[model samples]
Target: MSVKEQVCSLSIGIVLFPNVTQLDFTGTYEVFARLPNAQLYLLAQTLEPIRSDGGLTFLPDTTFTQAPALDVLFVPGGPGINGKMEDEKFLEFLKIQGKQARYVTAVCTGSLLLAAAGLLQGYRATTHWLSLDLLEMLGVETVAERVVIDRNRITGSGVTAGIDFGLALAAELFGDAIAQAIQLGIEYNPQPPFNSGSPQTAPAPVLARVTAASQNVQEIRRQIVQRVVTQLQTTNKLNHIYFA
Candidate 1:
């Protein structure tokens, strides 16, 4: 096959879980789906209508068993990541697909799930700003950036960063010309009414309220993170011993 045919025929799989933040995946989908001959797969445990945190529902195209080997594997996060951390089967599935994927990526807290799957081990990654420290505790060198591409493991910070991640992935997969054309088609110009996107830009009262609201989630994630890290460490030790 020619270079163009190879690029066009590649597969892109996006993992769908219960309560995933739709924009985290969709934003990237909007970009990647624009790639020439891109075959996007929505994968889940089953071919059901998976719901998002914001009440949106999406029908998955395939299940774990039916999923094909993907050139790109994407994971998106929301409140769902907390629950998925304990799902051994799903983590195993991720590990299997991720190891074979040309590019393994996540947006928002999705990276935490990747970490739990042992895919982000020793990689520099990023996630939602509020959860950066939590991700760091998972044995990843977490970076604070809109998008981080450490080798083939690309990660994006927060929800909106998914667009940037997609474009970057597209550029890597195809070329800057294709990525730029997609960006132009989407008209992804950002102009927020308020300058409160990040903690540094938000006012004290606004930041305090936001932090307070997420305190419960933070606490719960902290608990899960500790367990996940411990389990991964144990698994690593056992694997080392067995291999030795």
Candidate 2:
């Protein structure tokens, strides 16, 4: 059956953190928002406005505590993920809701948050090409594809790939026709100014510069991962105690 025919009410919760890449969220939003009977909520720690990595600002609809039950949960990625990885409250909230959400989705480095929440351990997933190896370090089997779907989790690569992730998810939830309609509505056309989306395609100098630019971000992410690992260990210890 088609999604429109089967779904009575579908609510999507999109987690927003400071410095989130706008395209990561908006690309998916454009597709899911167009679903016939879908509701979208911008979820954050506060209902106030948050700024994007590119200077855009968005106001969240609800705080984590106030968010309604969601059929799907989306986490978008950006530089801000470095800080969020170490956030106890944010990680705890994800651990709780992500376990119960019907579909958990992430774009770009957002999959890092899922790993931090202990949801992606031993799961197959994908993320921004630059961060793909990082997922493996967190116990996720990394895929190089633009989108990866493993059971209830859907993960996308890079910022713009969110659109593909959304369309794929649309196909999963509704039907192929619905995804095609949305794709047509959006006039999804790709005409990059340069053929340098990947290091293999880019010039050596360009690739070197890109790698240099990310060094600091990578260092910060390393610290965040360490903190998350520590938190997970603690959680595991507590679980053992409770069970014992």
Candidate 3:
């Protein structure tokens, strides 16, 4: 039997944190929630309502400790991911879940969190363009694509890329027909009014404006990523020594 034939039930857990980009989570949610025999859980450290970077609030239905072993472990990224890179407990949670999940996935800068947790070391992944270098510094082979699937590790680019990521993953999991039906159900058509979605497509002046505005945050993210990378390297070295 094929893999899809064997999958009778699916459970997906999406990790939540303060200041996450709500679109990063919700875009995929709209796609995955349509799967047959699937249960979706919004997971967080606690059940408290969390706010997004854009000031939108979301309520998590399950806590990390209480979450079931997931079929798909999803992580979304935003301004809040910088803090998560330094959060040991949160990284540990990802480490555990990522190990057992059938597919380890992320959208936007969520790939950074996966990389920070050591879950993406051998995977070719993608993240928001602004953080692609930071992800590479985390020892992940980075891809500059809308959706990158290397083995069971799937990653998407910036915010709006989540929809494309979702459809791609849906096809992988349930086959193209179901994914297409869902696309029709959701009317997943894209005709952006402006050609400013990516750095490559945006006008030079617009790109410069965005780059200038995010320079400070980028610097801070680089500093934190370096610290996290240092710790990861140290831990790897110790493990290598201990095992050797």
lDDT string for model 2 (1-244, tens) is 6544678789899999999999999989999989878999999999778999999999998999998878898999999998888787998888888888888889999999999888888789999988887777777899999899998899999999999999999998888998999999999888899999877789899999999999898877876677777777888899999999
lDDT of 1: 0.92
Please tell me which model should have the higher TM-score, number 1 or number 2.
1
- Location of the lowest summed lDDT over 10 successive residues in candidate 1: 1-10
Off-target runs (Cα >4 Å) in candidate 3 are none
Encode model 1's per-residue lDDT on 1-244: one tens digit a residue: 5333367487999999999999999999999889887798999999989989999999999999999999888999999998899899999999999999989999999999999998998899999989999899988998999999998999999999999999998888777888889999999888999999988899999999999999998999999999998998898899999999
Q: After superposition, how far is residue 150 of candidate 1 from its true place, in Å?
A: 0.6
> In candidate 3, what are the lDDT values of residues 76-139, reduced to their tens digit?
9999998999998999999999999999999999999999999999889999999999999999
Worst 10 residues of 3 by lDDT: 1-10
Candidate 1: regions farther than 4 A off: 1-6
Per lDDT, the best of the predicted structures is: 3
Scored by Cα lDDT, where does model 3 land? 0.94
Clash count of each predicted structure: 0, 1, 0
Best by TM-score: 3
- List runs of model 2 lying over 4 Å from the truth: 1-5
